[model samples]
Target: MSITFEINRGDLAKAITIALKFAGKERELPMLCGINLSIIKGQLTITGTDRFRLGLVRIRPIPETADGATNPDLDGPGSNIGVLPRATATRLLRVIGGPLDGRSPNVELTSSGRELTVADGETRLTVTLVDEKFPDVVGILLDEMERPIDLDLWGVNTALFAAFKDAAWRKGDHATVRLSTASRPAVVRIGDHFIGCLMPVQIAKRGSTASDWKEFLTSEPERPTRTTKRASRAAK
Candidate 1:
């Protein structure tokens, strides 16, 4: 069955922007070079991964039409996975997602069989699905994790990217930053809205990576405490 829905352009852009960090560029596997756009139930999920790092963003439910009728073309509460070209999707969103007539633009995505169509106002694009299956990005993000840490999503992104850049300079292009996850895959969360994971690269690990994290926590006291502080207080 075909699925069709309208999405806020700003939301779509944010998802795409985050996904681009993990989306493969000029890769052999076509599926690896695209973002996986899925709508399960009413939630819209965007995921991208290069097997080393993965990013997932879930937007709140897309709105129904003013008359309160669910689009009949939807395929119920199953996943509608569409692998879209990252570069093309990014460009499309940038052009059409900006303010339209001084108001936010909303773009419609229609999936029928193997093709996905995107349209905003007079601009429309029909992209054929890559003839490959997208890897399970969410599953990879959740797997092999000993601890989940709460951090600002933007902070994680900035620190990791900087670390990645530094590692590449000192080590090689295949370098990785050690996420402070107790010798396991590092998973980070920002409330319920976002989650990201990065695999550890095999190399001599660095020390004192926790100092920046400590400072981050000190600055933001509302972050969920990993330990039972209340229990400790009662014991004391």
Candidate 2:
């Protein structure tokens, strides 16, 4: 069976919200490093984790096709969604995050077995799945001890990125910044007021590319915020 779905910016935004969190973990098996998207009982479940934290989001698909006629050029009509490797999937989402007009573009996801491809009009992203089963993330999430605290999502991201970048210049094993939740939410004091959220971390690639790093840094609050002590390793 095949499926053709027209994804709008809102839908794409929500998917990225879920996908980025799942991609922020250390993977014992390389394939577990990607987000898993599966259609179950008429809803789409997106799951991600880095062993310490796990993020699971359920999304309902909007029917973008009519008359049962497959978009032919697009995957035909059905409910078969695909799993995209975290890095590639993250990148794919960024490319489509702009206006839905042709410039920003829409992406088409297709999968068979462990291989997944994300296509944007003429651009294509192909990734080979890591040949290992993702660990049971839900179980780990259930065992966590801390009660979830509410923080300003955008504020926290801005502060974290600034802290991570500032720590990059320091020489040490630990760098810590304590955010006070007394006045306004912690994240807003720093910047990034557009998207408010807490996300998990999954990938560990280093880079100076503005787009890539910016997207990766601010995608989720689930990613561990590294202080000077832990940040030193990444600095070198």
Candidate 3:
């Protein structure tokens, strides 16, 4: 059966941007590397994961009428699902998603057989879909990966590394900082001097070395590297 629907570019693009972060980058889990778009119970859910981190967002797609009423055309309550490969997601985001604002037109998405197409009723992009099935992330999160949980391991945003470097440079041209290995808000220090604290990003392991997710959503945190990136550079 061919499943078809329309979604606001702004909403869909924003959701895809967040989901891309969780999408698998490695080939180890080829199936988990793509973005999953599914509609269930009148809600559109977009998800992406790399076995280490999972991100999903639900949207009850509805349109606002002149009288402030809701448009029932895409008010969820429908079934249409597809997986956009990493490359495809990137391309789609770059194409229709770029410069997207609330006024951006709605995009039509059609999934038929092994193909998925995204267009705005004029120019269209039709690509082949992945064969792998997306896992029930909501179910997994409800049980296996519960909220308000504590673990030794934590994820850090790679972007913050620059700030750490900037702080060290500001302190001294070649200041050597000691980063404390903690679960959240990793403390950055320069000798006995405290620099700042950075929150944990969505990381799988606390260690520098790669570790498998023991059982899907579970992992044993490993000891962090003795020397941080900037520290090692200063030592050299």
Q: How accurate locally, in lDDT, is each candidate?
A: 0.63, 0.46, 0.61
Backbone clash total for model 3 is 4
Window of ten residues with lowest summed lDDT in model 1 = 163-172
lDDT of 2 by residue, 32-54 (tens): 57776655444555655544334
Per-residue lDDT tens digits for candidate 3, residues 1-236, read 67665667777776677567657778877778888877766667777766545556565554553345555564446553767889998888877766645433677667788887887755688888788877876565444323343455556677644444533213454434223334434434433211234455655444643354454468556766676876888899
What is the per-residue lDDT of model 1 for residues 19-58, given as tens digits with 9 covering 90 to 100? 7767777678778897888875466887777766666677
CA shift of 107, model 3, Å: 1.3
Q: After superposition, which runs of candidate 2 have C-alpha atoms over 4 Å from their true positions?
A: 1-6, 27-32, 66-83, 103-107, 120-123, 137-236
What lDDT is reached at residue 71 by model 3? 50
Clashes of each: 0, 26, 4
Best-fitting candidate, measured by TM-score?
A: 1
Better of 2 and 3 by lDDT: 3
Indicate the residue-level lDDT of 90 in model 1.
72
